[model samples]
Target: MKLYQPGDTSRAICPHCGKLVSTTFAYRDVPFEDGSGVVKGILAAVCDECQNVIAIPAQSTPAIRRARDAAEISLEVSIPAPEVEILDAAAYRVDPSATTRFRKSLFAFYLQRLRHSEETAEMLRRDFEAWNAVKTEQRKRVSRGIRIPHRRLSFKISPKTDRDVQWLMETSGMNKTDTVRSVVMEIEKDLLGPNTPRELRHLQDIAAVVNA
Candidate 1:
């Protein structure tokens, strides 16, 4: 199967819009069953004009074969109940991305159904209210401009600790960075209660600077 390397662009007719468009090849995370797991290096053709994915037969054939093999292996293995629940939740989880197309598509689908049924309308109304609440909180944080900046931290750990981290990744469905952050939060809660004096002083300092 021929694949386009990085910095290569090919002209193709976009199936979605029926227009001749430039297709850019990029490596994207192809999720297995929504987002249960991701195959990190899948080659895909994305149309520049329509912002839609163009189907490539050669690339898809091998992916389909690998998916079948993985599915068979998954059926043969036994997963713990807690792990299974985590995997199930991960399947529907969405990451923060450049585009909200998936979310918009879901909203459109629900909105269409709502026109025919009162129950659907009620559900959609509640969903919007919940979403708005989250947005409102985020906006408040942004307006305050006192959010801590994230920094990269690196350290070496023993093999036992590495194994524990792997276990936490499986159980919590968090990447290593997030798992470490969660551990730190738990430790802080235990040691300093919900609000630490140091943190309060730091925030106060920032507030004073902003006020000035």
Candidate 2:
């Protein structure tokens, strides 16, 4: 009943091809029974040869069952009807379909605003690039098998510092841990500027070589 790790392989008889085939564990979005929602990144087994999908048995695993419950709750939660209507009015002008689309047409709609100039489009592009950079760094860390250990820290700070942290949290739309991590990284960059220790600099050079 344990969750399957990604890239784990196993031998399975293919139902369609009736041959012994290798299967790999992967994460995929699985639609719910009512078809109204999807469970994103659910554990699944995929046949390498036939590309067949086999969903993990959620009922058999307590952890998976809890995750399914959380996903179901997220799906069941509804936005206010009036707010949805207002959003739909603005959104439908571009795509008109109930389903969201991230195609070029939608991108063009943002680039050439219905009423305004290209400033908003530029801002959107800049924001997207920044987000993509952060995601790319995270992917690199994962690829390198870098583990960021989690430790509980309980401390007190000045009211001004607390307000600043709160403002950062609100502006960046990031949770406390991410906001703190970003702030720490910024401070570390400044501290490591020109006179960084030889050992640390050597480590950084090695990391650059590995990343290259």
Candidate 3:
């Protein structure tokens, strides 16, 4: 691979302009691919016409990796036992070896999906509402319903996902733990279904990298 420095000129396809365009390498603050945080003053290929940071050069990768690692936030949630099983099951289904590591990746994947679209976020909201209703009814009939054991799950997440979780909580009107539970419920429905999940290959790809 070719390394680049500031002032090096190149040609590449520009997504903004939707065509092949001339680019110049320069030092600039570039946001993470998901637009969560910015890595300051990195050498990147900037589109000539659109003036956007089109791509990071090979040599600047280590700096971006360091920044990304530092930007990760901890996400923790106490969920019922079933949710834990569901998450692990989904992870195992994706890749038996990466079961534990993929839990974080699985949640992050859903976070990105739900963050970008309101329709997708509604899945979490609906699941949350259903859970609240069940818990309220169980409280009313305290002697009858069995209390499920709770387990705590914690992992480091990207800054973008942290923001997404906040947005999800705001829209779903649910606390962080319940919101996380709802996400697991959604995952159970999709990943554990009899029909092959549309994202099976995609998730497996993610699991491979996370394990690596």
Candidate 4:
């Protein structure tokens, strides 16, 4: 998508020269038909007076659309976890139920927020703990495994249209062609559904072919 915030000017004092500089930055989505099938864009910022080019973040621009879309569909709410009681070995042995009680208290507090009581809290806590443990184990499994390396390659594009790739890149904060290619690649992947793994393998093969 093209991103242009025309007439959006912010006054800021530059830390380097201590001069008030008017910053005009454009975000463009650049396309990448290379390996990884990743969407990459360029967020180029130029100092109006100094003519100094500052890249806002190539990764940021490239990743922004995907991240924003992900955020929109995500149900990842950040609620603080309940505080746990840390006791010495001797104390813990003396009061074995202390830890469980602390957990119980936390559940109670959480239940109260949900308009539930201690009775409901105890059941919810057990269920939550079970789910939490499963997630933790999955995390451990993923982390403990060594990751496989992927290949990277570069390729050229055909630009026979009047569509100004530079203009699209600067205004939309995306690589015009690369962004389009990336989006098409993603859509193709999504359409693959249950055969995503196979599709990904095919992608790797295609990447190799592109390089060859």
Better of 2 and 3 by lDDT: 3
Best by lDDT: 3
Candidate 4's error at 28, in angstroms?
Answer: 6.4
lDDT of 3 by residue, 1-212 (tens): 98787889999999999999999999999888788778898999999999998888789999999998888899988876667888999899888887577788898887676675666677668867886688567755874667768898999887767878999888777789877877777787789999899999999888888899
Off by over 4 Å in 2: 1-3, 16-18, 33-36, 57-212
- Cα lDDT tens digits for candidate 1, 1-212: 57567556888889898988898877665655533344556677778787666755376658755754454311012322322232222222322221222322222222232344445434434544464466458756776975434333333332334445555545545555544433333323322344433434433343344334
* Per-prediction tally of clashes: 0, 0, 0, 17
lDDT of each: 0.45, 0.46, 0.83, 0.37
The positional error of residue 21 in candidate 2, measured at the CA in angstroms, is 2.2
* Best candidate according to TM-score: 3
Question: Could you report the Cα RMSD, in angstroms, for every candidate shown?
Answer: 22.6, 22.5, 5.2, 24.2
Instruction: Kindly indicate the candidate among 1 and 4 with the higher lDDT.
Output: 1
Candidate 4 C-alpha lDDT tens digits along 1-212: 44546334555555555677887765444333322232334454556777554334444553755643332311111221211111112123323333332322222222223222444334433444464476457656875875433222112222211123233334334343332322222232233335534333443343344334
Better of 1 and 4 by TM-score: 1
- TM-score head-to-head 1 vs 3, winner: 3
Stretches off by above 4 angstroms in model 4 are: 1-7, 28-41, 53-212
What is candidate 3's TM-score against the reference?
Answer: 0.65
